[model samples]
Target chain A: MITSIIINGILIGLIYALLAIGLTVIFGVMRIINMFHGEAVMLGMYAAFVLFDKFGISPYISVFLTAPIFFVLGSIIYKFLIDPIPAREREITSLIITLGISFIFATSAMYIWSADYRTVTLPFSQDVMVFIKTRIGYPALISSCMSAVMIVGFYLFMSKTYMGRAIRATELDKDTASVMGVNVKWISIATFGIGVVLAAMAGGILSPIFYIYPFVGSNFVIKAFTIVVLGGMGSVTGALVGGIILGVAEALASTFLEYSMKDIMAFILFLGILLFKPSGILGGRTRL
Target chain B: MFFKILSSVLFLLLLFSQVSYGAGTFKIGCPAPMTGPGANFGEKFKKAYTMAADEINAKGGVNGTKLELVFEDTQAKPALAVSSAKKLISSDNVIALLGGWSSGVAFAVAPVALDNKTPYLLEHPALDDITRKNNDYVFRLQPTTGMYSAALEDFILKVVYPKEKKKQLTVAYIYVDNAFGQGVAKYGIIPFFKKNKDKFNLVVSESYNENAMDYKPLLLKVKNAAPDIVVLTSYLTDGILLAKQIKEVGLQAKMFTGTGAGHSMQDIYEKSGKATEKYFSSGPWHGEIKDANWKKWRSAWEKKYKYVPGEHEVEGYVAIQVLAEALKGVKSSDVVKQREELKASLKALNMKTIFGTVKFDNFDGYTNQNKAYKMTAVAQWINGKLLQVWPKEAAEREPAY
Candidate 1:
């Protein structure tokens, strides 16, 4: 039981963190809510499906290609739809814009894919390894490893690059960062792009684990949003930690309680954390 | 100007000719999930139902009266299905009803058929409650989740599970959290497993959201448990998704099974590739059999639709055959008489179908008649082909998986 709980908790938490990372990054810099964040994930799955079905490209390799493409598409969307709104009025406008984008992407996904669930299967797809008393799946291990690498790469990119610092500054205070010549608007757009890239990467890695459909992210997005908020919006590390914690909690609850109570546990944890530490565990105190 | 006048006269004559066609015409209402999440199945159902109706009409119109197929898309929602059923009854004044690929929609609209006193022929929805209740009008071709599961238990115990069954084969059962899934798990798998507890171990039984994308943890838990067999019952996407993940994670068992005929679809193998090659599943619908009636239906279906029928299509087609048989036996377009005749005929009638004999017992809603399924078949995806692996009398090929 202990082995099962630990193994289940870690693997589930890793994937959860991978999915929520994008939402956190976008929330960090954009200030405007990207309601279509889940659509990005869904689109990424579609992209992976197309690449595999049409070009015979493995999802593992397609992530690198799809990520940049989705990132650019995200940037273009931000430019045309999200950027024009005034900073003071950006939140509401962007909400409507992203929601509209989400619907369009979902509908477009249906048109292209036809709502059939697809998967990318390869050799060694059913390989399992045993260590100690706990058994682990090879594909799950690989996805967690990939997710960890990408999360670290995102951390370094944010901490070690000039554009990264500008993005961070904008996230801190767009008006102040603009006064300091940080190009806050461009940084916001680029940040949105980066967020999409993360989502695409996660999608590519996780597609084999989940079915590819137009509304694939419909259920996960709400949880992603909840995780992002629980992580204290705008905190990358917070998102990662929050997602993992949520996943672990849900897994444990499912093991102990009825499976119906799993989602309820996640919300209860959120409310509990909010009561104890309103700003979140890693969400630094700030004036919103 | 003369040609135009003649064409107008011809068109008016055609319209006038059909105006008197309703005197002996029978109205059959179709409630399907045409435009929503389950649209593909619904569309297939519509095609099959229409094709069946055309065949019946071509055969002198069921006692010299034409059969009119009235269709309404339920959008796979309960509220929409209820309203659609109402519309079909009130507006179309349909003598009888057909089509319901979704269980929730069927359950929601079942009352409408009762209220309107129209015999509702349920095609594909497998919820146990549809026939379990005391209803004279509702008739279903496909058995409930319980029937499928019961047949599966018999198949596994008798055929799949070896004579010297291991006493400690840990089993993890995961299913979608819905009426179909709940019904299958609660009434089918659990009871059978409980009776055979000494033969195998029941490790864990869990339910997951149908729309969940990340199932790594669930897979991980199953992995750690080292279950010998994993029984899964989910919709198309999640079913395939679970199979793919199970393969990628290298989870292996003596057998992996599904409750219904969902795994028999081309998409399951097409999407998951060799991952599901060796899996054995039981479904009430399979085409690779040698029943004369099935052969006729197959030839006609191929010639008409140009694609081989899936399980859903077969069930849909058989449902039409049932409705046609009932309507033909009744010889009346009156809704009340049609309902009575359809119900009586369904109970007493027998269909030699692709899945062999389909006969209903009494109207017990929990299961189909007293004996739930008309027929159950065990099939396997061996070498990229769905082969009938059980009921040796109908067995076309040996199980390769």
Candidate 2:
């Protein structure tokens, strides 16, 4: 039972990390929390749903379509909404603007889809892998694997690519990077685009396991925020570690205590991190 | 300037024309959650209420007065419901109020209706206290949360228990933590177990917040307990997720049942696919009545909505029909006197609708409660369809268990 709980925790944790990475990336580049992050994920879920419902496409394949579309959407939103704000007030103004954007996204989705809970049930969605007593659903396993691969690919891109280095330089010191010919503005746009694509891909991965709805994004946003804070504000490795810790903690709480205590335990851990380690596990170090 | 003056005059004429049109109509205020989590139920209430109103008007209207339904979006929040109720009563001057979707919203709006002395016909919102508060204006068409599982208990005792090989079966409950879910556990499932203590042992009772994404840890706990029966209470989204997760976690039990709410929805079967097969749900029954009127109404509803009406939609339709029946004899110039007559008519209501025999009675500390309705039915999902399986006469199929 304990082993199963831990395995389930790890599986869910990886997905949580994928969700938080997008939020962290946006924050790292722009120093502004993208409140519309969850809504972007919601749009991706809907995109997957429409593709499946209309064209008989699987969410796994739909991710390819969703990623690029969301990248463009994110870049356009940044250009029109985020980039217009003065740099001094960008943090506060962008927060409010993105919050509004989130509302618009959610309400528009509701208007179009009518608040119905949609699901994509693949033939193998329910198939389970059993090793001794530990059982894992195929969708969860596949999503976790996809999340891990994306995280690794992102990590490699950050460390090895010239654009990735330029984005990191822009994150470190925008003025210095601008003087050094890094094109900070373009880097910021690219970073925001990449961030949104990650969020949308996470949504595509989750479409099979979770119910898709207009407000489904709200269910995950709080947890993603918690993970981003816990892992250190802008650290990719921190998000991965933080997601695992929180997931395990919640699983343990649900196993021993009441099931409802799982979320309470998560919040308690969040508070503990905020109080005891305000910088987070990897806070102050803006590692991709 | 002359065109502006003429347009202003026309606008004033149009406004007065609307006021004159209002004099020939009797309005019922409907406070429903039209755009929030409860919006699904709200949409159903809107459709059902409109259909009933249209039908009444098609038959030369109620007492030759056109029925006008004034709808206000409550968003299923108490604060919004109260405001909507106030607006409906004061501005629209509705003689009666109908359609409270959630219990929290109902609790807030019920008092406003009472204060205004308007008859409030509660279509859904199953908390028992809504009717038990001695609010003279409130009358409910759907069964209270406590009564939701009455038919399920009967099915279990008579059919499931007798067939079980074990001498003492174990039970587990996993429900959403809310008024409706807690009410079912407190007043329904727990009492049944306490009554049949010798035959059943409740191993665990777990409650989780609504719209939670993960149930694997929770289902794992239920799996470890290995209860013979698992009872659940949830809305549509959570219900589908729980069903899927329960299957994913491989929690084997003799039976799994849900007490109304999401489990009773057809979306569960469609969304969860094979995960929900043989799952039983107990609530106000619909879709399988033997009456010709019910058949006609069902067909009409399907033709209009492109889907079969569920328990909530049926309850909404019945509430309107009941209100229309009560409004039939009321003919008075005084608004206060008309409201009083409507209240009295509701108290004395005993009619047959497609849903069931509608009758309100005061019994067991409940005021203006519909105690005579015997329509709570348990249904099971079998072969991608929800079919009534209990109350032998009303059942379309035998219990799959």
RMSD to true structure for each model, in Å: 5.1, 2.1
Give the interface RMSD of each candidate.
Answer: 3.4, 1.1
Per-residue lDDT over B1-401 for candidate 1, one digit per residue giving the tens place of the 0 to 100 score: 99999999999998777655645578788888765567667778888878877878898877777778888877688998899889988777777778678788888888888888777877677778778787766777666777776556766777656743665567789888887888788777877788888776788788888766556557766776888888888777777778866764556777888766467676777776566786777766465366677788877888987777767888777777776776667845556676677667777777666644567666433433435353666777787777667766546677653
Could you report the DockQ of all the candidates, in the order they appear? 0.33, 0.75
What stretches of model 2 exceed 4 Å from their correct place? B1-15, B333-337
**Top candidate by TM-score:** 2
Candidate 1 residue pairs in backbone clash: A125-B247, A125-B248, A126-B247, A126-B250, A127-B250, B131-B365, B132-B364, B132-B365, B132-B366, B133-B365
| TM-score of candidate 2 against the unseen true structure | 0.96
Model number with the top DockQ? 2
TM-score of chain A of each: 0.94, 0.97
Deviation of model 1 at B309, angstroms? 3.1
Superposed on the true chain A, the predicted chain A of model 2 yields a TM-score of 0.97
